[model samples]
Target: MFPTLLIVDDEQPILHSLEGLLSDEGFNVLTAPNGYECLKTIDAEHPDLVLLDIWMPGLDGIETLREIKKSHPGIPVIMISGHGTIDTAVTATKYGAFSFIEKPISIDKVIVAINNALNFRKLEEENIFLRTRMIAKNAIDGSSGPILALKQQIIAAAPTEAGILITGENGTGKELAARTIHQFSTHSESPLITVNCAAIPEALFESELFGHEKGAFEGATAKHIGRFELADGGTLFFNEIGDMNLANQGKLLQVIEEKRFCRLGGSRVLDVNVRIVAATNKDLRQEIEAGRFREDLYFRLNGVPLHMPPLRERLEDLPLLVERFTQSWCKSAESQPKSFTPEALETLANHDWPGNVRELKNLVERLLITVNKETIDLSDLPMPYRTPDVQVPADGLDELAGISDFKEAKAAFEREYIKRRLAECGNDVSATAKSLGVSKSHITKLIKP
Candidate 1:
């Protein structure tokens, strides 16, 4: 679509000339005789760019500029004046005018101004779209409950400059939560840099966090910007923060407290404006007690703590999650989406999801690729999850009769059968938990007593 431009001037000759010139330049042009008509055209057409004459009857250029800025700040407005002065131009610029063009304006300057303004408008629109997409991906969807309440709390707290601490088991969407908070934050327009504290080598932790000057250490050839410095005017997400070395923790504390830090082997301090969001599967409280984590740093990072419940706690949402994953996978893979039979869904929901949402998503993708059936059924499940071994014997026993409480007996037998299978799986908690369709923590709790 051609970009739209609105030209406003009391002089009929100037308006006709501008309309013809802009139209010849491949722009969709709308001409108005005065500021009042210009605003009305703006409301009606929502033009991408505006050319307003400074000396108009009734609502003048300055007043019209204020109204346009208040209503549609993104629309670029260039001021035109026949009796142009430095003071008038400065006033127009202060009131958010894109540029000022004097009367008997050069056609080339007018075209250039309109083109630049339209380009800026495009960029602003794209940024808004990207932000919206990020927020949509992070939004929580489900029926009302504690999960809904938690989502609301996160949204409410996201815009603040608070340092958030997110705690959850692996694959429980801790990263998603952190992103959601950052998306709605004051620093949303800024970058959100992530560092995996557990993944980084301990020897290089300081240089990584605080950066290093050229030749600061062995193999340090060039000056580098650290994650903290890069995240200035934005957010820094430290994943698995509990795994950071103790010595590095103290340095991090000083930086967080002072909002300034010097690069390694550098004398000058660099100031930063960054909000911190840290996440870890490990219990930081326990780590602190064990002297593996700093308590002072913990307090600073835990300005607002959000705990993401494991998948088992919100099992009711599993069906919806599964459908969402199935659709997502199909789109990415360019294949027809698959659906699970009621029995299959029940089996899926009953099994403990050891790896949480990540595990479930992986399984869904696996099923989409491997399972050929139009509808996944019980028999289509992998070996360990097909059915309890003891159920085979029960199937034969129904003919023998005299089993008055068969339901309770079946339940007991199934429980014991799963326990035996779990043990046979080497007590590799995650594997056993996945086979049994339960969370690793739940499996641990079961076997603990």
Candidate 2:
């Protein structure tokens, strides 16, 4: 687990001396006589750090440093020089050198600089990893055609300045879509401010959208910044925007259009630059028709439209979603991971998920916490979720009645029996076959396309 260091210098004495000293100090060291060899060694070894001399014969340190940065910017490079200047050091720093050291090299200083650069690199790597994990955590989880199309649309629209309107049913992930859009948008560095239009009181709507000065109102004890100001240079997500009253809608529309608003009891107009992303479970078109929402505001916010599909429409993604929720819950709780039996998954797939993804996540977490077993089964599900066990329901019988051929009817019944047995045994084909007193190949053949 020793860190590898690559030393690039024209002086063989310097290289040999540093190699011996560094090797004794517990570093896996590689020496290159010139810049060309340095680049080659880097490509071959991918060393953790580089020490480059400014005065090399061919392909001098500056040019080599540029090429190294262009190809492997993450590798920390410390520049060393016998004839050094402020300008040279500044130029190296501009070119992404981690540190610069004067020659008549002190091993103590070299070790200290190397340790600092490695620590810095480690922190940068950890930061990148955490950021990647954060982005993945907020990512939309599904592979259904609708979900894929929606993701593409978000990618296409996220970088632009145009406002986005996300519409979907309750628990259909409108808020999640908004957050994902913000995460991918150009203004990702800034905070994504969320305002629940339905939850905000009408009396304080203006104050919430635009800041109020100290003593502006009875409860205003100090200066308060509003959501719009907080969202400047970032995204402002209006959840359930369709539920915003007409009075508040007009005020919002004004700020969005003018890009400037004055705070309550403050005369100074603050110009703001914010990407607007709005979401609602209710149909805005219907709301506009019924005079509950403003048509002007709808047009302003609907520069781009995105829709989240309900869970029932993407039933094929249920298993993946279940796994994501299960792993997330298990990780957060520091508990042993649990899995769903195929029968349990089948029962879940059968139910029309009225509450969509949120409901499914809640159900999975509840089962993990409540059901004590590792494998969730069909019988683990409550009534209404598990498909009824009645022998050939009247509707199913009527459908089968159309197939008058005896062989066809027998094949249909056999297929259903095989499917049921497969689910019961958690889709373990061999286990299903053993239980049915049939060979594994026979079960596989029966289920093959």
**Per-residue lDDT of model 1, residues 1-449, tens digit only:** 89888988999999999899889989899989988888888889899889999998899999999999999898999999999999999999999998999978899999888888888878989989988987987776555375787798898889888889999999998888888889989999899999999889988888888899999988999998889999999999999999898888998899999999999989998999999999999999999999999999999999999988888888888888888888888888888768987777777877787798899888888767655445766655674445574133344335435545978666555555556556556557776666556777876665564
Worst window of 10 by summed lDDT in candidate 1 = 389-398
In model 2, residue pairs whose N, Cα or C atoms come closer than 3 Å (at least 3 residues apart or on different chains), thus clashing, are: none
Model 1, stretches more than 4 Å misplaced?
383-449
How close is every model to the real structure, measured as TM-score?
0.83, 0.75
**RMSD for each of the candidates:** 9.3, 10.5
Superposed by TM-score, candidate 2 places the C-alpha of residue 7 at a distance from the truth, in angstroms, of: 3.1
Q: Assess the local accuracy of residue 358 in candidate 2 as a C-alpha lDDT between 0 and 100.
A: 88
Candidate 2 RMSD to the correct structure? 10.5
Mind giving the per-residue lDDT tens digits that candidate 2 earns over 1-449? 99999999999999999999999999999999999999999999999999999999989999999999999999999999999999999999999999999989999999999999999999999977876887897899989999999999999999898999999989989988888888888998788999998898999999999989998989999999999999999999999998898888999999999999999989999999999999988888899999999999999999999989999999999999999999999999998989998877977998898999988988898777655557877655766676677223343445666788999988877777677668767798876776566888987877888
| Candidate closest to the true structure, highest TM-score | 1
Q: Say which candidate scores most in lDDT.
A: 2
